[model samples]
Target: MLFYNDYPLPLLGWGKLRNRFLPDKGKIMTQAIFKATIIAAAAVFFAIFVAVVVPPLIAQPDVVGAFAAGFVNPYASGYSSDVLACWVILAAWIAYEAKALGIRHGWICALLGIIPGVAVGFALYLLLRMRQLKAG
Candidate 1:
């Protein structure tokens, strides 16, 4: 079986390296790095939610009705439907990658993230993937 052992790892890039190898002392460093990334991501998500998503929901006279119109109405549903599909694809991708890297709790974070928001799930996966992605 072919593995990605021969590939060069990027110092700052998380994607490929996180899934491939770990340096001898990678765990401690990865935790610190993941902690920083998670904090930044959480701040961004919260800021966007408070500034953007909240205003619209607050402005809506009938919150349930608004949701129904946006989610159930075919005319307005196309874009959201596509986005939902994308989230599913993202979830599947995260799960598959986590499995391949043997990252413990990665899938759990991803699944939980989906409940609150896909962004949350992504952040959780990123936070929990430090050990798998560490490289010397």
Candidate 2:
């Protein structure tokens, strides 16, 4: 904007381009939804793992055997085993992608998340990745 002879004129320039291209509404809502869903899903996944795992551990005397139940025998069904296998594979892939993306603390997040539950690990990795993406 400039003033000449007490009259003003506004220049249409980079400011207009910046505002025109930037998103304004619903950005907060999108982030909030992502967070809410991640928290809810991760909580449910952890609860399911506990219910499926703890009872067997309590019923068995051998700690190793109890933990091993996740891989074998009357403890784990084929469906459960397949699901767990998928999670491991998926986590491995996420770790690879995270490294490729140069996300900080990616390995730690992947290990913790995958060891506890793939859903937790993946969510955490994604959250971290989102931050890194935004920063760059």
Candidate 3:
């Protein structure tokens, strides 16, 4: 007599298969949310630090003072324009990534891009996550 029965397998029997093929959606969402929150908080803290601490530190400027003066004074003429150019370039890169990859991947790229600085990093992360749908 045949040992096997009608249904392909019981749900219990399929556990291993399910585990291999599919991830736990809830867990993934939680992780993503946690990461986004941390990134946002860090950006806020960095902004505060720059505003409150940086100016006083600059006033004293030991070794760092010389460096800051050297850097800021030389480019004073068109600093704003240079800053705008850098931001535009960064925005374009983020847009390209968003178009090429899904939002999640785009976010990953943005987070990595944060090394350039906090504002750019936060902007990229926000832009990537602006659209909610996951990429196929």
Candidate 4:
């Protein structure tokens, strides 16, 4: 039996460049979309937590003191150390997730993650993205 396949062929003029690159375009596009979605979601969650949860915690001196006494006192300075530890943990988690997702620059992801720790993660993420595009 002699049956013809229905798929369209590339135009005759495209040359080797077209053939070499065309097949991977779909894969690249899918990866890009996935990465964008993940970054966007992470940024949103980070922002919400920072803007909503952190300020009140900071404003309440009694709670802060309690947190310091329970979690910070044995270490050294107290509140600052606890904050730094929190930041480090947050950064590490971001780095881990970014690496897992095959992001090219994990440090940026970590920095963006830390924004929520300081109560500005969302704004930081937007600023970082703008800066990254400008630099690139």
Off by over 4 Å in 1: 1-38, 47-79
Provide TM-scores for the models: 0.46, 0.57, 0.30, 0.31
Error in Å for residue 70 of model 1: 4.3
Q: Of the pair 1 and 2, which is ahead by lDDT?
A: 2
Report the poorest 10 consecutive residues by lDDT, candidate 3.
1-10
lDDT per residue for candidate 1 within 1-136, as digits (tens), equals: 2323444555565676556555444444665676887778877886786687677777876756755665776767997677567678777777787568766666676565544456677676776665567841
List model 3 lDDT by residue over 75-118, tens digit each: 66376456446656665766775676645455454544433344
Tell me the lDDT of model 4 at 40.
72
Taking every candidate in turn, the Cα RMSD to the unseen true structure, in Å, is 10.4, 12.0, 12.1, 12.7
Model 4 scores what on Cα lDDT?
Answer: 0.55
Give the top-scoring candidate (TM-score): 2
Residue 94 CA displacement from its true place in model 4, Å: 9.8
Query: Could you tell me which residue pairs clash in candidate 2?
Result: 113-121
